[model samples]
Structures are given as structure tokens and as C-alpha cells.
Target chain A: MLDAKGLMVFYENMLALNNVNILCKENQIVGVFGANSAGKSTLMYTLSGIMEDIKKKEEMAGGERITVSGKIQYKGIDITKLRPSERARRGLILCPERRRIFKESSVLENLRIGGYLASPAQANKTLDYVFKLFPALVKLKKRVGGFLSGGEQQMLAIGRALMAQPKLLLLDEPLLGLSPLMQAILIRATKVIRDEQQISILVTEQYARPVLPIVDHAFILENGAAVMEGSRDELLNNPDVRGAYFGV
Target chain B: MEILIYGTINSIALALMALGFALVYGISRIPNFAHGAIYVVAGFITWTFLKVVGLGYFLSALIAILVTGILGALIYRFMLIRVRGMAISEIIASYAIGLAILEGLRWGGFKGMTYTLPVFIAGSVTLGGVPVDIHRLLLIGIGVAVIALLWLFTHYTRIGLALRGMAQDERAALMLGIDSDRMALLATAFGSMLAGLAAIVLLPLGNIVVEAGYNVLILAIAVCIVGGLGSWMGAVLAAFLIGFAQILTVVYLGSHYQMVVALLAIIFTLIMRPSGLFGRQKELEERV
Candidate 1:
């Protein structure tokens, strides 16, 4: 389980995330819904400790001044100050937005790269599990990552994350630019991964209709704040939530 | 037949010289300007170990390579780590380190044409009715083996896979628990070892002079620039192109014009295609 309290991120004079609190219980699929520029990705980055890397790079380049204030606890350990790789070592893996797969590498290479943290046997087992979860990847083993279709790339991205043997997986915009059918397949696979692997998932999305039915608990983010948090049925009953996110 | 054989040898030699520079740049985006210094220093170290310390050639070469690798890692840890992400600072710091080492060696009395490594083997062989030294043939064999080994290592080994991941996407690699700093350190060390490998093999062909340090740096940069800064395959291809051109210039225009070929290749590549032949970053961007 992961607990984050009073998360605030500032980019220069602009507020990217403001006083947001989120939690993920063990083996649960938690969804964070938000529209464009709603701090969805920022929250994910902050929680996964990638914001620290961005902050360092920006500081080095004399670019934008990014200030992040948050206390994140993963399995009873304070991890807000930990580096991204350290956080990943503790099983907090983020499958970033835009499917940042190694483009020049082959599909198998991407998956192997993702297995950097795994033991040899664990990597082998996960390799099997990944290929089993996304059968399309098996045939595209030799194909370069960039050449894959959007859906395939997304699958490879998720598969790559799985290779890290994560306890909690962060899915950022996994359905972006994906077709309805592909979305359904991915969503189904997400659920199957949770049930089989018993890994907690914190998935973020702009549109909530497709993802709503699968999430155990969901938080609706608006303008960098968590405006609503409820169980699946509780959120579905809320008229405002239905109107804004479900397009009702 | 002479041209063909010598051209292949020259090409592989150029590839050997540039591989280290290309690798360090490719993985960490740190233009290791100390590459030539490492090469020259390794040659000197090998000479010291062999001549002064009275060690065997093989042991001296191995020890020299290990020392060079540590030196490179220390340079990264002490100097390059601070200036990382700033391109100009990175270049200045590394080139400064290179200058200090090369000049320091020159000042330290590590000079003269007498300092030379013996050839790995003695005598020449008749290949296509042309006499080629056994050492040159051995260099070609080692070069090919090194490339093949590197290919296998990157594809099959865990650390190698992690390095390849970091080369493509640093942040993404971080997300998967591949430490960027650790990978960079590994890259620098491995690159230094490669430079040492090149030195031990090629320095035997000529004297280990301080001037060769500056010349090696220029030649390495030219090959890397013409090949594509971070592309290993591009480096090999560009090496062949530039290497053969250099050989042709040496045969026709005189030996003095050889260096001009590499310089010309760099300038031509810059004017025609700034990204070089195998610069996948820009091409990948256009694709996506």
C-alpha cells in the first residue's frame, strides 16, 4: 500500500499540483481521473520520484524552477526523498505516459532492458508472463519498438514495466490514442494482471467512462486538486462525476 | 590488392580508435575528450610495466587497461559528474582533463620515438601476393572479435541491456531501477578500457609520442562526427569511409594528406548532414 499526503508541486509561478492526497491499497486498481493539464501526470511523477530527476535536470539547465513538497509513504517507509531508481527498487514502477519505450531496440530488448532489476530466474518467469499477457508482443519480438502500432507500443510499455517485478504499477495514460477495442483489451489485461500478479495499480486517465467499471476506488481530479474520492458505485451515483467525466 | 588489404586494416584501426569515444558519448552523452589521453597513457603504462617493471607483455597490457579504466571512472566521478548536463562545461572539463594528462606527460619526460611497443607477432605473410605484417592481420582479427563481443554483450548481458536502455532513455531506465550514475560510470570505465585496447594494439605500429595523443583525439573526433556522434554502427561505417579515403590520400597525394581526409570527412558531414549517417534520435523523432 502507498500513502501520499498534502502533495503540492509548483512550476515557476504556476501551480501544477495543489494539496492533493491519494492512497492505494494492496491489490487494488485505483483510478485518478482528470482532464488536460489537471496535474494527473505531475501527481504520478511526484509519487514515482521522477519529479526529483526533472527538478535536478531543470536546475542544472538553468531552466524552469520546479518546487515539489510532498510526503509519500510506501509500505510504511518515507519515500518522498528517495531517487526514482531507489523507489523502483522498492517496487514502485511507473509506466510513464507517451509509452517511452526504447524505440531503436527490438521488442525483446525493451523487455530485457526492463528486467534490469530482476534476478535472472525472475526475469525469465516475468518474460514468459509478459508475453502471455500480451500475445501480440510474442510475434513482434524482433520488431523495433518505434515501429509498433500505438496499442502494441502501449502493451510493450506495460510489458516492460511488468519485467521490473513491481509490487505497485503506475499506469499513466495507457489508453491514450488507443482504439475502443484496444482500450477494452488493455483494460481487461490490466484487471487480469492485478488478479493474477496481485500487484496494486494506480492508473490515471482523462476520460473515466471506459476505466470506471474496472476500478475498485477512484479519485476525480480537477485543476490539480482531488475534488472527489469514492468507491466505484459511490462515484457512479454522483451526478456531477457522471456529468463531467462520464459525459452523461 | 595492396590497397584493399591496407584499407581494411586502416578502417578497422580507425574503428578501434573511435569506438571508445562513440560509446561514452552514446550512453552518457558525455563527450569523453580524455579518450586520446587514456590511449596514450595506457601505452605509456604498458611500456613502464613491460620495460621498467619487467612484466610480461600480456600482463603489462592487462594492468595498463585496468589502470586506465580506473582513471576514467575517477575523472567522471570527480570532474565530469559536476558538469554533467551542461554540454559546454562537460566538453571543457573533459578536454581540460585531457590537456592536463597529455601535457603533464610531455612535461614528465614521457616522450621520444624510442618508447614503442613491440608488435604482437613477428614477420609478415603473403596475402594475395602482397606482404602484410602479422601484427596488422592480428589487429583486424581482434577488431572484429571486439565488435562481435560488444554486440553480444549489449544484447545478452543484464548490465549491457541496462546500458542500452540508459542510452536510449535515461529517465525511463531510472523508472525500471537502472541507476543512471552507475550506468554512466560503467560506460566511462568500459570506454577507457576500449581506448587502452586500441592503444596496445595500434601503438605498436608506431612510436608512443605525446603528439600522437593530440592526433588520436582529432582522428577520433573526426570519425565520431562523420559517423554520427553516438551511433556505434555509424562509427564503424564512417571509419571505413574515412579510413579508405585516408589510405587513398596517403598512396596518391603523399602520407601527409592522410589527416586531411578525416578532417574533410568531418566538415563534409557537418555541412551535408549534421546528424551524421546513423543519428537515430532525429530520424526516430520524425517517425513518431
Candidate 2:
């Protein structure tokens, strides 16, 4: 239940995303595939309202200005310019890349913050559900996040986001720097969340093969534009996509 | 006998002072250099309202704590939270506020002068064969009582737990729906209030000069470090250690290098533990 129309984003002077649009159905998983410098993260940042675009001529022309013009709607609520915390409270949670975990904090403490948007009762329920999906998190509750291994950290990061009880979860490269087994484990958790809670997700990935099988729809982005968009089967059969993206 | 009593009293009061500084540092994650200034002004306020304005000591302490709280909120809302920039800017703002208070109070007649206590609690009592000033014994008792209360507040209160949580992870705290700005304000005020209590107790012991703030400030820093930066018990324990050290050193080695020795203790702790006695090992990455 999310819609993006005519989304444009630029980082300072560099154009990172242009004229992008996508729709996410309820309970569906949408995968966006792109290479490095393909403006994937830029689009996500603009949609998430973390970056702001300056409108002055000096900034827009040549200065380091992230100029963004977009209309991002979640469940018909216009959140194109809402603050990050407000957006989170409205259930648009980000499981950011590079694992933005509070390393010095304990695992349970990290999860407790995820419930920022939920009611006290809802927070308790969300914590229980997250613990179930990532059972390893429960045993290591007292341990600091910095001390946890890579796989455990990733799981904790994802679990922390889930505590927010988001309506449309945004995942930025969940597979980055993780082993195949860890990747599979996280990928499985994504499916479980969608199945059990009916929450939609928009996930961006650098590699397609590992993520696309579970995705209901796929968008192949090239250079700052959406070059391809189709259902899972259509994307799988497209010769151009297979050659350019899959290298098959 | 006097030396022993002096050392015990000074140890407790000094610990209380350091606890205030450590509390702000631990929760706000900023040194809040203005904290000493806050303590200084709290002393002035206590004297002003208690003596000049003819209010009783108890009432003056109450108003001083409230004013300190408001001062903290002003720093947080107008300066710390709203004026967004690096932490250096925030610290500069706090220092500026402290300077402004110092200037304002001086302009209003303080003039780099010292304060006098109208009431005095003079007399002596012997503790286990040691003769001690009654007021100082009261100071030690007050210190212990305040420490117990603060320990309970931090351990049992919901907001206190949230503050501890915020200190560890601000974003996570925000995610948990914790009101961070409010928490910061409360912690800042509560911390300064402890310094005010210490100041209140220290009255009648001597005159409180405008420049007298840093002497206690230095010891508080030492206590925080030896106690482990934000560790409550650590600050308390370190306070006692530093207090006893100051007493023992002054008696044996003379009083000249007491400040120097305290500074050395801070340096040694930094080189050795870096995290303070109870402070957690900080993460390598700068917070996002």
C-alpha cells in the first residue's frame, strides 16, 4: 500500500535518481536491482526523507545540493517531506545498509527503541514476535550489540526495525557482506514477516539472483532510471534483463 | 582528629559534586562544561534567596533547583536540540550560557566577590574517639541520603531507565518513543540540582567565591573518571577515594599540589582505563 510518482533525487551536484515511480501492493515484496552508483540508495534516502534538496540557484546549479522532488504516499498518506521519526511512527521503517546498530547498547535495549511508534502493549507484542523470528536475539539479550557477530548483528538490526511494526518495510541491501547461510536466514525471515503480519516491503539489492526468487515484482534500474519493471515470471523470462542483470 | 573529620566530610561533599557532573556527562553524552557554572550559580542562588531575599535555607534550595532545571531546559530546547551542529557547538553553547550567568550575576553585584552564610551550624561531636564538627557530620549524612535516593531514582524510575537507555543509544531511545529532549532537560537539571545540594551543605563551612567553582569541578571530574565516567557507584566511590586522598595528601604532603594530584589521577585513569572505572568501552564508529 505504497505509491511513488515522478520521484527525482540528486546528491549535491550529481543526479542520482530521475523520474522514478513504483507501486507496492499490500503483503507484497518488491525487489529493485541495481549496480553500484545506480542511484538505488539515493532513491531510498529521498523516499525516507533523510536527505533534503536545496532550491537556491547557487545550490541547484553546481553546488553540492541534494535536489529532490517527489510525491511518496503510504496508504494514501503523503509522507514526501515528513521527518524521519514521524515517518517511522507512521510505520515506514528502514532496515538500513551497513547495519546502523547501536553497538555499545545491549540487544534488548536496541529492540526496545524499535517500539517507538507502537503503544506500550503493542511494543511488548512486537518484541515477542521479533524474538520468535530471530530466536538467537533472546539468548544474547544482555550482550552488547558491538560484541555480537556479523550474522547476529544483522538479525538484531532487522529485529530492531520489526519492533517498530512498520506498514511498508524498506530494506537496503540486507545481504551485504554476509555469508550465504546468513543471507538465506535473513531472506527467510523477510518471507515470514510478510506472511504472518501482511506487511508490504520494498527491498533494494545489488545482486538479483539471491533476492528475486521470493520477490513478487522486480524493477531493474540502470544509471538513474527504471529500465525494467515486471512480475517475477516476466522479469525471469526477459532476454535483455537476463543478459544485463543475471549475466545468463 | 580534626583532619580525620575534615577528610570524611570533604569526601562526601566532593563525591556529591562529582556525581552531579558525572550524571550529566553520562546521560547527555556531552561533558557539559557549563555544569560547573551551573553548580557555581546554584551556590549563588542559594545565598541570594536564602540571605539577600530573606527566604529560609530550605525554600532557597528548592527555588535554586527549579531555576537550575529551567536553565537546563533553556539550554536543551533553545540551544542544544534546536541549534543543530557538531557536539563542539553544543559544548560552546553550554560554556557561553555559563559565562553569561557569571557575567549577569557579577553585573548584578557579585563582582568576582565571595558569598557569606548568614546561619552557621557550629559545634563538635566525637565519632569513635575522633572529634568532628557537627555541621560536617550532617554533611556526610546528607551525602549518603542523597546518594541512596539518586541510586533508587536511576534504578527504579521509568524515566531514569529510559535516560540510561538513551545514553547508550539515542536513536534506539527515540525509536522506543522516549522523549529525548525532555529526558535530556530533566537529567541536566537533576544533575545540577545535586551540585546545588552539595553547595547548600557546604555553606557555613566557608565563604563561596565566584571562582571557587572550578576547584570542586576538577575533583568531580576525577571522581567521574576513577568511578568510570557515568557509573553512579563509581563516582561515589571515586569521590570518597579522592576525598581521602586530598585529606591524606594535605596532611602529609601539604595542600599545594592537591589540584595537580587530582589532575594526574584523571590523566592516569585516561591512559590506563580510558573508560573510567565503570564506564562502558565506547564504540569505534561515530554515532549515526
Candidate 3:
């Protein structure tokens, strides 16, 4: 389980995220729905500890001052100050926005790199699971990641994140720019991964319809603020939520 | 026939000099300007081990390589880590380290041409009616072996894959639990070892003088600039291109013009293909 409370992020005078709270219980799928510039990616970065890295880089370059204040509890540990790599070592893996897969590496190589923290035996086992979860990747093993189609790249990205053996997976816009069919396949696979692997997932997206079926609890983020939070059924009954997120 | 044999040998030597520079830059994007200084230091360490400690040549070389590796790691940990992500600072910091090491050695009485490493094997062999020393032949063998071993290491091992991933995308690698600092430190250490290896193999041909460090640094930079900065294959190919060009210049234009070939190659590559032969900038632009 992971709990993030009172998270606020400021990029100079601009507020990227404002006093937002999000949580995910063990083996649960939590959906965060937001539109453009809704701080979805910022939230993901904050939770995954990548914001700390960004802040450091910005400080080194004397660029925009990034100020982050939050308290993140991951499985009972205070992890707000942890570096991304350290967080990753504790199984807090982030499949970042835009599918950020290693473009120059082959699909297998990407997966192997993802297995950096795993023991040899664990890596082997997870590699098998990843291949099984994304069967389309098996044939594209040797193909370069940059050359892959958007759907294939997203699959590889998720597969790569899985190779890291995540206890809590944070997926940022996994369905972006994908066809409806591909989205369906990925959403189905996401559920299957949760059920089989018993991994908690915190997935963020602009469009929530395709992902609505799987997520048990969901939050609606509007302009860096969490506007609503409820169970899937509770959210579905709200006409405003349906109209804004599901376009129903 | 002479040109062909000598050209290949020259190319291999150039590759040996540039591989470490390319590797550290490739993985960590840190242009270790101290590469050449590390080479000279390795040579001196080997000399000390063999002459002062009365150790065997092999043992001395091995310990020297290890010490230089640690030296490289220390450089990264203590200095490069602070200036990281700032390109100008990174270059200045590393170059300063190089200058200090080279000048420090000179000040410490490590100058002059009397210091030399013994050749692994003696005598010369005739090939195609052209005579070549056994050591040069052995250098070629070691060069090829190093290349093959590096290829296998990067392609097959877990750490190698992680390093490649780090080279391609640091944030993505971090998401997968590969620590950037640790990887950078490893790269600097391994790169230093490669530099030391090159020194151990090549120093037998000449004296280990501090001035050689400056020449090696320039040559290494020329190769990296001509090749693409971070591409391993590009560095190797550029080494051959520059190497053969250097040898050809030496044969046709006189030996003194050899350095001119490398300098000219660097200028030409910058003018015609700023990204070098296999630079990633073009690909990145295309992707964008």
C-alpha cells in the first residue's frame, strides 16, 4: 500500500500540483483521471521520486527552482526523500509518460535492463511472466524499441516496468495515442497482471472510459487538485463524472 | 603491402586509445579528460611495481591497471559528481584533474625518456616481405581480443545491458532500479582500466613520458569527435578512418604530418557532419 498526503509542487511561481492526496491499497487498481496540464504526470513523478532528481538537475543548472513538499508512505516507510533509484529498489516503479523505453535497445535488452535489481532467478521468472503478458513482444524480441509501433512500445514499456518486479506500479498515460483495440488489450492485460501478480497499480490517464472497468477506486484531478474520490460504482453513477471523464 | 599492414596496426592502436574515452562518455556522458593522464599514470605505476617492488611484469601491469581504475572511480566520486549535468563544468573539472595529474607527475620527477616498459616478446617477424616487431603483432592481437570481449560483455551481461540502457536513457534506467551514480562510477573505473590496458600494451614501443599524455588526449579526442561522441561502433570505425589516414599521411606526406591527419579529420568531421559519422543527434532530430 502507498499513501501520499498534502503533496504540493511548485515550479518557480507556477503550481504544478497543489495539496493533492492519493492512495492505493494492496492489490488494488487506482485510477487518476485528469485533462491536459492537470498535474497527472507531476503526481506520478512525485510519487515515484523522479521529482527529486528533476529538482536536483534544475538546481545544478541554476534553472527553474522546483519546490516539492509532501509526505509519501510506501508500505510503512517514509519515502518522500528517496531518490528514484532507491524507490525503485523498494519496488516503486514508474512507467513514465510517453512510454520512455530505451530507443536504442532491443526489446529483450530493454527487459533485461529493467531486471537490473532482480536476482538472476527472479529476473528469469519475471521475464517469463512479461513475455506471457505481452505475447506480441515475443516475436519482436530483437527489434529496436524506437522502431516499434506505439502499441508495441507501450507494451514493451509496461513489460520493461514489470521486469523490475514492482510491488506497486505507476503507469502514466499508458493508453496515450493507442488505437481502441490496443487499449482494450492493454487494459485487459493490466487487470490480468494485477490478479495474477497481486501487484498494486496507480494508473493515470485523460480518458477514463477504457480503464474504468478495472480500477476499484478512482480519483478525478482538476487543475492540480483532487476534485473527487470514490469507488468505481460511486463514480459511474455521477452524471458529471461520466460526462467529463468518460464522455458518456 | 607495408601501408596495409602498418595501417591496420595504427588503426588498432588508435582504437585502443579512444575506446575508454568513448565508453565513459557513452555511458555517463562524462568526457573524462583525464583519460590520457590515467594512461601515463598506469605506465608509471607498472614501472614502479616492476622496478622498485621487483615484481613480475604481468603482476605489475595488473596491479597498475587496478590502481588506475580506483583512481578513476575516485575522480568521479569526489569531483565529477559535483559538476555533473553541467557540460562546461564537467569538461573543466575533468581537464583540470588531467592537468594536475600530468603536471604533478612532471613536478615529481617523472619526466624524461629513460622510463620504459619491456616488450612482452622480442624480435620481429617477416610478413609479405615486410618486417613487423613481435610486440606490435601482439598489440594487434590484444586489440582485437579486447574489442571482441567488450562486444560480448556489453551484449551478454546484465550489467552491460544496464549500462547500455543508461547510455540510451538515464531516467528510464532509473525506473528499472539502475542507479545512475553507481553506473557512472563503474563506467569511469572500467574506462580507466581500458586506458591502462592500452598503455601497458603500447608503452613498450616508446618511453613513458608525461608529454605522451597530452598527445594521447588529443588523439583520443580527435577519434571521439570524428566517430560520434558516445557510439562505440562509431568510435571504432572513426579510429580506423583516422588511423589509416594518419598512416597514409605518414607514408606519403612525411611522418611529421601524422598528427596533422588526426587534427584535419576532427575539423573535417565537425564541418561536414558535426555529429560525426554515427552521431545520435541526427536520429534524435528525426525522431522529434
- Each candidate's DockQ: 0.89, 0.20, 0.73
Steric clash pairs (candidate 2): A12-A64, A12-A65, A113-B175, A113-B176, A116-B175, A116-B177, B227-B234, B228-B276, B228-B277, B228-B278
Interface Cα root-mean-square deviation for all models: 0.7, 6.3, 1.6
Stretches of candidate 2 exceeding 4 Å from the true structure: A52-65, A243-248, B1-12, B23-30, B52-57, B81-84, B111-125, B132-187, B201-204, B220-241, B266-288
Per-residue lDDT tens digits for candidate 2, residues B1-288, read 756777778789888788778887778765666666777787788888977899887898888877877776677677766432245766687777777776676677774435766434678877778877777778888888998988777654556666776766654455444555567777777887787777777755767666656676677778888888767788888877778888888888888867776788899889998887766544344322
- Residue-level lDDT of model 3, residues B1-288, one tens digit each, is 999999999999999999999999999999999999999999999999999999999999999999999999999999999999999999999999999999999999998987999999999999999999999999999999999999999988999989999999888888888988999999999999999999999999999999889999999999999998999989999999988988899888899999989888889999999988998745853673
Cα-lDDT of candidate 2? 0.76
What is the Cα-based lDDT of residue A209 in candidate 1? Answer: 94
Q: lDDT (CA) for every model shown?
A: 0.94, 0.76, 0.93
User: Docking quality tier of candidate 1?
Assistant: high
| Residue-wise C-alpha lDDT for candidate 1, range A1-248, written one tens digit per residue | 99999999999989999999999999999999999999999999999999998998899899999999979999999998998999999999999999899999999999999999999999999999999999989999999988999999999999999999999999999999999999999999999999999999999999999998999999989899999999999999999998999898
Candidate 3 lDDT over A1-248, as tens digits, reads: 99999999999989989999998999999999999999999999999988888888899899999999989999999998888999999999999999888888789988998888989999999999999999999999999888889999999999999989999999999999999999999999999999999999999999989998999999999999999999999999999998998887
How much is the lDDT of residue B63 in candidate 3? 100
Better of 1 and 3 by DockQ: 1
Most accurate candidate by lDDT? 1
Candidate 3: lDDT of B7?
96
Q: What is the CAPRI rating of model 2's predicted complex?
A: incorrect
Tell me the tens digit of each residue's lDDT in model 1 across B249-278. 889999988888988888899999998988
